[model samples]
Target: MIQLHDKIFKPFISSGELDETVSNMVQEVTKDLAGEIPVFVAILNGSFMFASDFLKKYPSNCEISFLKLASYEGTSSTLKVKQLVGLNTSLKNRTVVVLEDIVDTGNTIVEIADLLANEGAKDIKIASLFYKPEVYSKDLTIDYIGMSIPNKFIVGYGLDYDELGRNLPEVYQFYKQTDK
Candidate 1:
């Protein structure tokens, strides 16, 4: 159990499990894009940790860039995605893979894919460490997914609550006490 700000959280996923999931995702990507020399665009702040682990285990040549987007104020999404930092690299005619920490309602990633497509990216792939299928409403397909989780507020392994709990080795979901 852990507390961040005014919320209590309970253990949801272990660090070992997460590592295995990431490794598997990387392996799958390598198999499909070994010699493609894809460009990996990591969504910043929240994706820092996942990007680090992902790039380290990726056994191929790839270009990397960061794009920071914000859609959450606290534990919930504001539903308005804002690009805090823009991508300087040219994605034109490139196979771009988007690295995200988590995909919930999918608004942010959808917007990113659309922008990359508009910029002339030959192909765009979405890879996320965590996914909330229950709440994901977008039509975009996630190329590689680490885990499919329920609609729960989780933090840790790059996810956070008001900028807290991102350093936690494992993942935790918000805990609500039942009044008995």
Candidate 2:
């Protein structure tokens, strides 16, 4: 168990399960991309682990890049995205894949997609490790998803609370405030 924001979160998804899910998702994405060599754009600060794992399972050729965006004020999102680190590569006419740790409100994904489009990316797709359907508000399509989870505060596998607990190998959920 781990503590965050005065809450205790028990382990939910184990490291093995995360690996399998990411592997399957990567395989699917590779099949979809087929002959095109897509650019894997990892959303930084949260997707480092997921992106690395996913890339290892990818059986196709691709390039990798990083972009940093911020939206969370704490456990809850502020629903506003701030571009902290911009994209350095030219996305014009390139096939771009945005890798994310989680998609809750979808605001961050939408903002990133729009930016990529404006920069002339020929195609844009999202590959997320987790999806919270209940709170997801954006109508934009998510091209690929690893898992759908219930509404809860989650950490680990690169997810964090106040910039902590990201080093855990498995995913955990905060069930009570006292645990933290």
Candidate 3:
């Protein structure tokens, strides 16, 4: 169990499970991009750890980059994606894959796809580690998904609450707030 801000969140997804899931997803993604070497653009802050693990099992020749976007304040989605860091490479006629930590309202992924399209990327694929189907509102198709989780606040493995507890090895859920 992990304690955060007076609340205790039991382990929901262990590190081993996460690794196995990622490995499988990487295999699927590599198969999908078999003919082309795609440029993986990782959404920063949250997807950093997931991106690293995923690239290890990708089993293909690909380039990696990072794009930082922010859309959350605390544990709730603000429904707006703020692009803090921009893509430095020209994606014209290039196959690009956007790696994300979680997909909630789908605003961030949609925005990223649009941006890449505008920059002349030939194809765009989205690979998310976690997805919340209940609240997803975008019409875009996610090319790859690792897990579908309930609409609950989660932290750990690069996910955080109030910028704390992201370094935890496993994913945890916040059940409820405790009295301080």
Candidate 4:
């Protein structure tokens, strides 16, 4: 268990589980990207940890870049996305792969995809470490999903709360334990 702010969260996803899932997903990604060299655009901050694992395991020849986007303030999404930094690489006529830590409301992903498309990316693929399908409201499809979780606030494995808990090796979720 871990504490972030006033909340206590219990272990949700373990480190071993993360390694196994990422290993399996790498095979699928390699097969899907057999003939092309894709450019991986990793969303910054929260995605740094996931991207470190995923990109290391992704066998396909690819280039990597980063874009920083912010939307969440604490456990809730502000629903208003902002770009803290911009993309420097030219995505023209290239296959682009976007790696995200989590996809919730999908506002940020949609916005990034639009910009990439407008810059002439030939194809775009989205990969997310975690997905909350119940609360996902965007039309874009997540091409690679590590896991589907309930609509609960979680932290760890690069995910943070008010800039804490990102260093944890496993995921932690809000626990509703009570003592009488």
Model 2 segments more than 4 A misplaced:
none
Poorest lDDT segment (10 consecutive residues) of candidate 1: 171-180
lDDT tens digits by residue: candidate 1, 1-180: 988888889999999998999899999999989679999999989998899999999999999999999999987899999989999899999999999999999999999998899989999999999899989999999999999999999999888999999899899998974343
Which stretches of candidate 1 lie above 4 Å from their native place? 177-180
- The lDDT of model 3 is 0.91
lDDT of 2 at 146: 93
For candidate 3, the TM-score is 0.96
lDDT of 4 by residue, 1-180 (tens): 766777789999999998887787777788899999989999989999988998899876789999999999987899999999988899999999898999988898999899889989999999888999999998898999989999998888999988899999999998854342
Candidate 1 global CA lDDT score = 0.93
Candidate 3 stretches greater than 4 Å from native? none
Output the TM-score of candidate 2: 0.96
TM-scores vs. true structure, each candidate: 0.96, 0.96, 0.96, 0.95
- How far residue 88's Cα lies from its native spot in candidate 2, in Å, is 1.5
Model 2, range 1-180, lDDT digits (tens) per residue? 877767788989999999999988888998889999999999999999999988887888899989999999778898789999988888889999999999999999999999999999999999999999998988899989899999898999999988888999999998777822
* CA lDDT scores, all candidates in order: 0.93, 0.91, 0.91, 0.89
What is the Cα-based lDDT of residue 162 in candidate 3? 84
Whose lDDT is greatest here? 1
Clashing pairs in 2: 6-177, 7-177, 7-179, 7-180, 8-179, 8-180
